[model samples]
Target: MNMNMNMNRKQGQILSERFEVAFNQVHDALRDIVQINDDRFVVLVKVGAKKYQIIETYKKDLEQYARLRNAIVHEKMEIGFYIAEPNAKVVSHIEKIANVFSRPNYALSIATKNVVYFDYRDSILKVTAAIKEHGYSKFPIYKNKKCVGLLTSSSIVKWMAQNMENSSVNLSDSHVSDIMTYEKEHPIEIVAKDINIFEVENIFEKAHRKKQKIEGVIITEHGRADESPLGMITAWDLIQIDYTVD
Candidate 1:
């Protein structure tokens, strides 16, 4: 029984050391991402609070772990003996956090690569056919080689409802420009390609809190409207992502 207790204690000490290493790695990863050169705690508070939802969700817990790490490292130890050992739960939590930083899902990695878009002058018939044949509900409407607006199935439905009164109305006769209305309420957000999934999730969360709808995130090289979009991310795309942290 005494030997077993010693073994458990030794294992706890080893795990505590591992937790410290992982905690530092997570901090370093954040520092690199946020370009912070100050204290790790400051980076944690700023980036965890503002930038990433995953880190924000675990912020308090991570802060507590950081304090614990400091205590463990700074505590006086007897010869070849640990003064304190980290709990298994804390170690596990820190490990999960480390993994989150290490294996991040970037926007470019998950976004739909081959985007199907329509020009503003294109016939509505083409848009309808694309929707029906390709199962795509959203399309970026372009003008002068720049994405000016988004055409969604909901907008099309609304347009159809307003135009159904005209007995002579036909999709072939209507242009995308005619049906497309600038939706000031739900504007498409542009984000850089390097943005992580956690940041993207935070964007949606913030929009929800403000009662604003984000139609989609248009990923570009520098997140500029003038730059050609590299990929696209919708709320549905985020919903389909399995964020089950291991």
Candidate 2:
């Protein structure tokens, strides 16, 4: 036995003893490493081109296990995903995340609290600031406390570029309301609070395909007008989910 082999055996023994499990065949390799990205300290995992996120608050000493596996991989190794296993343990592992995802009010409603909206009479600067602040590429324009239309960053950028050469350009003259596509003019797809993220994801894709220019989905309790727009889910928001955590 060489030194490297002996060292690996010792490490394996330590892991087995710590986890209280006998060694088995390698299940899956962990590749495309990810770690805590958000303030919530969630574990993000990446494999190939796909990614998964797991809320780390419930991990209970799992971080130690994760660090051990990360050290073994050292940018050259991969860890097995608990979900890929057929054993009963996989169910419990999945349940932890399911609990977070299953709570509709927590997942969907929480997002609504931070939604961005633009008033119809607001100047371009006001609209621009809201977009930048909320990190949303598009926003819902409201007039008289009613939704007027959606204004997109792309449209605003185009207008800016068109008047770039003109030194007399007055951004204040341009009101978001003038540029908004009134709610009555364009069809809006509203997602309900009870819907799953998967379904909300589908609505985003479908709306994008049909409206080519639209990228935002207004979420509501029952898709009603009286219900204030909870939050707008966008393609950009959904794409973030492509990454994984395991």
TM-score of 1: 0.67
lDDT of each: 0.76, 0.50
lDDT accuracy of residue 177 in candidate 2: 59
Q: lDDT tens digits, residues 91-198, model 2? A: 334333433333422236434455677777888888777766776666776678766567777777667666665565667687875565322344456666676554
Candidate 2 lands at a TM-score of 0.50
- The C-alpha TM-scores of every prediction are 0.67, 0.50
Candidate 2's displacement at residue 212, Å, is: 5.5
Provide backbone clash counts, one per model: 0, 11
Best TM-score among the predictions, by candidate number: 1
lDDT of 1 at 210: 89
Q: Evaluate model 2: give its lDDT.
A: 0.50
